[model samples]
Target: MKLPVLSLLVLVASCATPGGDAPATPAEMAAQARTALVHVEQPDPGSPLLQVDTAAIADSVDDAKARALLAPLLSQIADLSLARTHVSVASADWLLQCQSLRRLDVRACSRVDDAFVRAIVALPQLEELILARTATTDASIDALLASASLKRVWMWKSAVTPAGLARLAARDGLLVDAGLRPSDSSAEVEPKPEFVNLLPMPGEPALDAALVPINVNCPVTGAPVDAKRTRTVNGRVVGFCCNNCPKTFDADPAKYEAALPKP
Candidate 1:
């Protein structure tokens, strides 16, 4: 996704005029970036699986005007409630730019720890924080308590203990959701079917579907057909008197494929 070019134009226009405050922290840099985001005329980049970071722009542009101009394109940012994005301690600094942020979902993020929790606590406007299935523990729960605006915190499947929950319960206004729930989208996904080989532990039999049976019989053992012991190969059903016969037949089906009754 491209950064706001118009903001850059504005930065260029402001260059000849001189002095302004330089950003110090990631959040400060992100604040400068927000101005650019506001002026961006292009389409939304959408939630990209791989994020393009703005570190290079912040590093290369030593000019205060140029750095201020480019901050919005370089910092990792989300304007609204950032949900379901892969956030961890490493990239959590990106959220510093989202001054309007209210909700954050870092579920299933293995790297989420006290550092990430502390970083977000500084956001004065943050409200809902979802850390289900993440690695957060009691170490950062106190930091969360510091946010006067926070209303709800979801901590299911995290490292928090009952004691931690008890401590949070003392707070007057906060609501915590500690019940077990799936971490991703609300949709229920069905499990895929599994197949097992019938042969004994040592070998895998490669069966050929080309052989057509002439009669109903366990071609490998010459035994009468048993409906319970059947397998389909190449769209045709083959049966055997015992379950094991199918394995032997499968080992070298061509030897017996012609022996069964043909279609």
Candidate 2:
């Protein structure tokens, strides 16, 4: 897949102007680079940090290359931010190093998981976290509470379960947005599927016509697929929003044999 651009959502906002709360000289502003970080590299003497970053990122077409491009960024940056950058597990481990970090927002980053969530709890300075519309879950919230220093957590339309919310509510000091439910889209019009039994994971968007709804659910957590959001591959087959889902069914067709709809 083509890589997306990096933004400052999870990192410090841009340096302000020098004189009017800003500096007229670009060099002066750059001096405050401590406040934020860009994916561009900075080395001594006309170094090619920028060139390397761009070039490496361009190689994201190969997953391994994408991983290599993201490796340098983690530990060195004091204020690492890659909001909506669609980070993977490796990148999350890198972000754990921003010792001075105060805010981390991975909003709309689709591939988040328990490991990344657990990693962020170690950031003592993290006061505000935004995981809106991501794959966050109840376990993630539990980890967030363990941080002790966290004051607010904004996670709208995520997978924060009712049990998870109750667990945290018992402890005061959390400003949570964990009540939202997934698959709550009451179709403005009734759906047209003949027989439906499963659905996609929350917030994972449909891709091309082939993959209207992605199924990231595990066996224990699977939900019914909504026909309105699904497209037929063959009369007996369907597609997923991401390459990651459909793993189990692919492994043993016989295991899910009975679950398949009749042709």
Candidate 3:
């Protein structure tokens, strides 16, 4: 007797591979993670079961989701971006397990603070970190300073003060990006030069001209520097995005000077 369509479908489904509903393997977990909107890279398609090399869960991933999604692939993840997630210090335990993690981006994860930074800095291979818009302060800077493998840290918009940035920048080869340079008009000021030269001199390479600011963004506001608004400070030219930024720099030169490229 011929079976009904539903029965036939069930029969076929029953005959399918065993363990189909069993616990997922690492590769399967990666596929499932991807389905949940986590961006994962296997790096080598030829090896179908290869572990994921990179994973970005920039969505609203909290501590529980972070643990669930990353636990299976922690060993292989080299680059991870948790930017904009809701993860907090509770997720740091799993992040610390990412032994191979080289770069991490937790930018905009407001819940992440100095405690989280302290934990992740222990990752032996962590090299670059992006912590912009978080609550981390100078304590985070102190934790980051102890990381032997860290080469760059972007902490713009955090609580790190200019003094904190200077301390971190003092570390050789460590790049520190502390949001817009701070300025206080009330702070003690230096005498402005009677005549400041803003133009590149003849026969000078524009790229290397002393009047050309080494940074493309205004040190005071982190905005695109306007070539016309330039000032010579300590023999180096500094550029500002607007007339007001130069004034801001003039008010407190030392605070902004740390943001300029080191001599």
Candidate 4:
């Protein structure tokens, strides 16, 4: 009796045969996605300018897959535009590969840090660097100053200090935003409460008056007391040296309460 071979064929097709082509690797899948992104050409070889809108891929792929796919392609890229994405330090290998890179925009990439700044210094052709709304701190400022080719750096909302900006301004033509708190011209100055004047003990730095009332270090991070940035727990004000310190303290205020002075 001749059985229908069509059923057998359908069964074989439904089952993924091992001998048949294997599935595409993560890197390969990423490469296919990357090829569709906006590509702008420059006078350099291999069309060095690459604009990666990672925001487009964020929903589709995790960070590892994206890095594996894009890292190899950055070897010849000169200009990389990464807006609104977390570029982790593990991807440093690919960024450092851009030897001819001139302009880099990392706006709103909070994951970027001082190490990224140090790595980019190797790019001799780098001229304009935008690091707005990043976690980059004073640690990267000296490296920026040392760059012979860097012209303008925009670091608005970065952790850079006023002192660091002053040093950068001393350079002949380098431009940097002050990132200073905007003053309200229309607002009238309110008189300080008597308690405010009474808070500071005699013979301390004037700036200390604005810091939290703590003689000892922060129990959480061991940072010096900060008068300006504080959190009140159990009807007592506690000082924190860094912006994130209070968060650490708040996770379990009871744990650090013993370390704090009586209010």
Candidate 5:
């Protein structure tokens, strides 16, 4: 007996594979991901594995969508870029399953905190990590130190302090890009003056010309001091590079005090 067209189509679809239509091949999954604006690259034309890059569609991807798109391809993806996406710690947990991932970029992902760092560092094959502009702080650095395979980390604009960066830099065979090169850390390097004149605030007394600043450089920023911007702290005169530096110094005088030259 002849079947209706709709029924025939269903029968054909079921017969096409033992179960429902066979689960999508890695190549097919890659194509599907591309249709969603995710950039997918195969090692070669015929390779089933992929390199998923969501940077182009970062604004559109949230935690749920990230899971949906990456769950099936986790094993196949060697390099993944979720840079600037809205993914949080929830999505970061999925990365632990991605053992094949070699390089991962989460740059500018504000939700990537120490918790997220702790999660992804568990990825055994992760080699290069891009955490620049994220919320990861010094604690994240401590978490990353446990990773055996991580070789490089980019942390410019991150919450990591200079000390944290220094600790990470001390690791053997690990490269850190914190917006400063090895030469920039030299003790002999002189601080360049960013601003010269420091106008006094309304009703504030003018700076004393005869008074010398205890520190030749702005302790807070490591910039050349503006002679006109001076403040007396703990019976010592401190100088700053620009008008803003004084405010930063005021907020936490003790923190910057350590950089000042001692008597």
Candidate 6:
């Protein structure tokens, strides 16, 4: 009798667990994609790009059941930050729960649309929006204007056009493109086989991450290396859209590195 009681106590004590919710780790979230399915596939804090969507998983089963499975997964995404990694939202509900979304920054969200607007409308101080390459059009300009708390709107090279820009100009305290938005010097320049042309910009537009552009003269074509598509360093031949530049640069990286801007 004493042995049986002692054994029961050991099993229960071995199963002791933390009271708080177990924050899903990158590995556990990746596993969620396996059995549950998702619309978009992007990993965070765990691995490289897994561009599969949970919606695709739902669609495989049937259309009617798709939205149901998506609701819960999307709700879990309370805060979305796409710096070193990108994530797929199952739906808009996931973003809405972020009680303190003071700044809703969306960049390179090519699939975004009006459905996501209501999620951000309640954000009291949405001062900055960098919609560099998203699908949100001038039509959604209404949502931008309706946000009584909005200050700065950055739709650099997205759906906003010249006519659309004029329509948005009428907003009371908002700053639109041309003057309000930072101008892209790259757009003004003609692509050529020379150093990237510059026009009086005080400083370069901040790069996305730890990438330093190294422009080296092509040893083979003698044109700028933008055309050279491939390169190799430390005994590895890498490919590039601007090809031949690599062979020349790989020949001597120290020389090219000397010319490159310090990261």
Best by lDDT: 5
Superposition error at 184 for model 2 (Å)? 19
* Clash list (residue pairs), candidate 1: 33-72, 54-74, 213-260, 213-261, 213-262, 214-260, 214-261, 214-262, 215-260, 215-261
Per residue, candidate 4 scores C-alpha lDDT tens digits across 1-263 of 11332342233233224455422453332344345332333444465354444555443333454454454345545666665666756556667777767778777777878998887776788888888898889999889999999988888888888787788878987887656555866667778843322254478655543344543567687777666667666655566677887788878878877887665
RMSD of 1: 14.3
Ten-residue region with minimum lDDT total, candidate 3: 48-57
Q: Give the better candidate number (2 or 5) by lDDT.
A: 5
lDDT of each: 0.59, 0.51, 0.75, 0.64, 0.80, 0.47
Q: List the residue pairs that clash in candidate 4.
A: 211-227, 211-228, 212-226, 212-227
* Per-prediction tally of clashes: 10, 12, 0, 4, 0, 24
Tens-digit lDDT track for model 2 on 139-175?
7866888887787777777787768767766668878
TM-score of each: 0.40, 0.42, 0.56, 0.50, 0.60, 0.37
Tens-digit per-residue lDDT, 60-84, candidate 6: 3222233333222333332333311
- How do the residues 176-201 of candidate 3 rate in per-residue lDDT, one tens digit apiece? 88765557657767798543234566
lDDT of 5 at 113: 85
Off by over 4 Å in 2: 1-80, 179-263
- Which candidate has the highest TM-score of all? 5
Off by more than 4 A, model 3: 1-25, 44-59, 180-263
Candidate 3 collision pairs? none
